[model samples]
Target chain A: MHSLTRSFLAVALLASVSAAHAHRTWLLPSAAQVDGKDPWVTVDAAVSEDLFELGANALKLDGLSITDPDGGSVQPNQTSTGKYRSSLDLKLAKSGTYRISLVSETAMASYKLNGEMKRWRGNVADLKKEVPAEAEELSVSTTLGRLETFVTAGKPNGTALKPVGSGLELIPLDHPSEFLAGQPARFRLLLDGKPLPGLTVAVVPGGVKYRGVLKETALTTDAKGEFTVNWPTPQMYWINAGYPARVNVPEGQPRPPMPAKRYNYSGTFEVLPQ
Target chain B: MQKRKLLLTAVLASALPALAAELSVKIDIPQLAVAEYHRPYIAMWLEKADGGQVTQLAVWYDQKKKDNGGTKWLKDMRQWWRKGGRDLEVPLDAVTSATRAPGLHALNFAAGKAPLGQLAAGEYTLFVEASREAGGREVVRVPLSWPPKEARSTGSKGQEELGNVTVQLKP
Candidate 1:
């Protein structure tokens, strides 16, 4: 293999190792909070390690949907996709919290001979599933990714923000609109309405432009399915949390412990400076 | 393993009410020594092991108070407020009631019913958060399993405002 290609594979392996199971699909707004007078927020959606830096690559926005504070739909004006990033612009008309949600279609592929999964950008087919006879024996499956974020104009009016998605969900008990810097914020995580304990919820300050290794402060929820994160500083914070689904083998199938399906849930809420 | 699996399938397919599960919660309100003591606002809800909120069972406050002033202190039950309290309007029927006097108060709901019945089968935590006016705040959590594969119950004790909280899931 060429030196460049070999180094690229090394980086991918290193990134995957460091992230563990971090197929985090997050929706990041240019600004989580904006002035009501001229409220316009740019949103970036991606399946990546640090929200939307394109460290892995850009994810397609086929199932992208944005709802304004008044429950009206906000359309993306300009959408441009690059090797690493996909950007869109949203016009914020009303003065409330706008919810952005993107549901990626399921992308599946066979595992490498060494049992490691291959990385691919955008949506693609599982060649192994298509031609089973010609494909490898063992395979990997990733469930659809669900990403969501919230932005606000004026003070967070507490409108249009509800946990209705079917993925691993984080429901902010405190209003995300009223987050203050340095104050602790509490959130509850649930999968199918059940409190998920021991979830590693990470909070990253700023959007993709964060410098110095993308420092993220993470905390694990207690037995009560709750976590309190004290934002180190007041800035636009992207809080990402998720878990993998259990793998159930069929009744008569040889149980070699199949790989579990993974799901990613993410959101962005700003903690304004006091 | 096979027998247990078959039994689980049979129970899931059974139409008999004997398979129905019932959730009962007992919350103790401690009588504290303080001047002008008022009953604390209490909120109870079910959450999955992953922290997903199921359905809220009840919120006890002075709903009958004039000007809806009792709700102003509801935020003091900080855990419940972020879980689902802030999303709801005050005086939610069947879910909101006046605070109970200091004692062990019991609330029951049958499975396949509105609140508890709406719950998807899973292991859950019953969170009971209490915040009193001119008093301390406390929260207690008890683990519970629904669609009672087997009859089970769990309980926990609170520090100050709240006392013992017991959750029983009966088949």
Candidate 2:
């Protein structure tokens, strides 16, 4: 009996350790319910487990699945978080209000019907509600702010242009109309190819305008030398250009011109219907 | 006398779409709904009925947008992204537009030098593809008749806000 008892205790101990290693957690997500407007469900969840051995924020949808009441699974896309993306082909699979079973490495968390799963606009609204109104003022516009965020070691710091790595390189999404009237596209800036750390580094004009109205934005870049913005509306747009600078290393075959005329890169294009 | 002869030649060339060549087509764009007041990127072109490309008509583009001329956004058109948007460093400026409220839009086109009549009579198609920033897309095709029927306008529906899109030629 003593031997049996000891063996049972050992098994329990092993199980507990295995559970602890998952290190999964529910990143804060805001619950929402709106009228005809599509109420979005934004969860800052993270799956930091070795099962998939995904990268730090490998949030793309490989394991995560959502089944609606109609017996169909949901497909997610327009991934603000690139770590894990699912259902990116655009249209949702029409799950019709079902439970979102979030199965992490160790945590088996789930969200009840929560609210109406109308059209999910996981953007603007989600980032606006809980996020500071000031921050919203910054994130809501389609112009680049002066904020630059740096993410290294453990602390994610925000600063101006003083970046840690080489510099910020902006890469835009591949769309048919690179230039459009009112749509918001993406321009990604990287530090040595890898993400700048924080989220995105956007490029925009001095300000933005809407509904025959114009307003200048204030929010600047964080430290990682990154920001996000939508494409300007249909109008003549001219804004100062500035990007995160890189560390001036001395050991390279060649170097760029002094101070780098890249300070305010400028070019122009047109947008008209054919 | 020489100028008069040139004028006559130009008139004859422009009047030929009725004799041999015909123009017909449809344009479609895939749709993805997102949240933003911006319009989708669009691409329009011509394709031979037998699956050969004829020429690129236009690309809905934005000039004031960031990296607007990057040439990368061309891929959003898919078909254009694959066939040409990916490579062509087009000489002309981009053609884009602001987002439209829920509704329909009809358009028209004029004749090209030597016009449709100049081409050898055969089957052809008109293709238009559109991709919005935070909306759905559509690719519409309209079969061109040997001679246009007074530039009739018609369109198909899209999942997102995009409804019917009709393009005809004015007599």
Candidate 3:
């Protein structure tokens, strides 16, 4: 009985680890700020367990979008996907801020059919037609996630920072490219164009391998959906926040109904030394 | 009494020009003994005491590069770039010049001039930042009280990228 209990605990631990600490997706720019008459920035897209160290899997670029300083859609000059990361070059003709993002939306469901558990994933519009009508113990959920970063060719501007009014968004009170070490930077969180309060934001600085410590800082938004981060040093940082924290149920107990939808937002920012 | 008051106003107005101060800045670019050396890019500007406003004084870079390639490295002067340099169009005829050799350089500006003409009478700070291609970066600051109460000098020193930097105010 003791050995069985030990094995059960091990299984529980594994489940929690996989659910809570899944791989993180990010987009890293070659330079957050550039100069000169004609400037171009290269971006790397990847998913890895470690922060900013691209070795796990290349993040697909199908949903890639680039917003120029004028709030107009722009295309990447060149793109390539390798085993570990995807890279793209974007020419910045205008002299202001640009937004690069990977946006995706999908539907996921699980149900018991013929006493066997089945799962399906597809676009939201195909959910009804794909899933069987008589499936038992059916549960469905939708996910919308955005991973983004900002680059400024010359003077930074706010034209490309307007929220899309659908999923989670980060609005910077202080210009992202102007962040300095030991200084506090403010940002507001929104959901569906409205303020999202009391959400926890995880800020992890890059160079985890050299530091040997995660040094992740957790900040909670106030009533106004605003949070501030005091950067520790000059380096690239990843900021992430998600809604609907995972719930753990006891064994032999029926799992509670999961939330119908989930939203996630993450951005990479570079901080300079004072 | 009205005639006397009019005469007093004219006297004060005429004295204003005489009170105008002249600012002289001397910057020293150090010569480094390294395997590879490139002349450092420099940016000079004056900021209000509270750091509210900035007036660019001069920028020394490789103006002769083909297709204006020299401006590409101007961002290496990170502090100046973030403060106000990034927005400026390089090769500005008024304040832009070619890179200088390793020596003491003097720049003089009159109080009633184009760049300093609009400056208000108050405390101000001068910033001189330098960044080299294959070397280090440094910044030197000097403080001044505009329309000087008396002639005075203030300066700062940089260890590696620069040498003695002095600012003189003459009434």
Candidate 4:
């Protein structure tokens, strides 16, 4: 029993370390809700674990797509890509909710048994066809990080607040446009159309340009996959949450090879000042 | 005499938009009776009725200083910094200038120029945000309709950081 506890502790430590290093993509807009008079809302997007440091070096723009309120496609142009920041701007033409989503291409990580120790090297897609299947038990994992946010113009009365389909999604319990400073905003996490509970949700006070470390208030969801954060000040915030899936070689059951999966979700909302 | 008459008509045609779309902004850098009085960084831009950026009219900071020292303080103007100011390399041609002192200053943009040229016959909100060192910050958003519809002019009074701000969009 003591040895089993020690092994469990070791596994827990490894999971915590990996979670700390996981990168997330964040999409932030200038305003969560705009009145009829304001013509546009500028959105800033980046892939990074730390909000201040955008991972432009490894980040690609091919996965970005925006669906406007009128069921039209709105393209966001890459405005700038500095060393620590990458930004995009969108021209909000009509009044309704705009959905900005980033769907990344799958990245593979594989480890091979070399003599006694397993060495993680090269892309699994390339190595799988070359490496001999008898020489190793391949443990490969595929990761697809997704980020999305919804902003409205005029009012959110007719806007659809339900899921528009994503691997992991955080839908605001109430209208995001109604979020005001000093109010507790609630959101529900969904994984495959069901509630996801006991996950860590982080809320960063400022947007990507915030020149500081990743200091955020971490909150946990309840049994119903709901979490709340009381915004003290009126400012831009990036809320992030993630989940992982792991599967191994089946016991006596023949099934096709499957890679483990990890899904990350991030959303940005503004707590309007009074 | 025909040549002179043609010249007069051409000049009037060119000046038509300028007379139609005019913005007279009065930014007062409050004279704080203090020792370390660094001029505040100010930015003026127009946004469409839906919150889209129209054009940046002027951004005043310490441009002449070497090594781009003045830009370091622009983050103090939070709203503009997030909008589009951070992407702009300081000392931008025709758009950047030195900081002003406490008084009323005038800025005129001709038709077929920034803002006026980009104006697409719609409603707009003029945003003026200012930030100072060791001082308070303020943002003023003014509302206006494009093409003036009928020579419409609007103005607003700042509480502390700025003075009477007026904009005229004529037809």
Give each prediction's root-mean-square deviation over alpha carbons. 23.3, 23.1, 23.6, 21.7
lDDT of 4 at A72: 64
Write out fnat for all predictions, comma-separated: 0.00, 0.00, 0.00, 0.00
Model 3: per-residue Cα lDDT over A123-212, one tens digit each:
677888999998976667777889999999989999998887879989989999889999999999999999999887888788865553
Query: Per-residue lDDT tens digits of candidate 4, residues A1-274?
Result: 6444334433433333243344445676777777767557766666554453444333455677787786667787446655654567766678777777776635333333464323233333555664556544444445556677777877574345666565788888877877898888888889877888987777866643443112356788899999988987777777767575332223334333333566777777878876
lDDT of each: 0.68, 0.36, 0.81, 0.65
C-alpha lDDT of residue A143 in model 1: 54
| Backbone Cα, N, C clashes tallied per candidate | 17, 85, 0, 13
Best model per TM-score: 3
Give one digit per residue, the lDDT tens place, for model 2 in B75-133: 65676777566666653432334333333443333344222323333455666666543
> What is the CAPRI rating of model 4's predicted complex?
incorrect
TM-scores, chain B, all models = 0.85, 0.60, 0.87, 0.81
Ranking by lDDT: 3, 1, 4, 2
User: What DockQ results for candidate 2?
Assistant: 0.01
Deviation in angstroms for B158 in model 3? 39
What would the per-residue lDDT of candidate 3 be over residues B72-162, giving only the tens digit for each residue?
8898788899988999988886689998888899999887785677578778888999877634577888888887777788899987778
TM-score-best of 3 and 4: 3
Residue-wise C-alpha lDDT for candidate 4, range B24-130, written one tens digit per residue: 55555555432123466789987887758657778999775668877877876788888888787777776888888777777776556654465666777888887
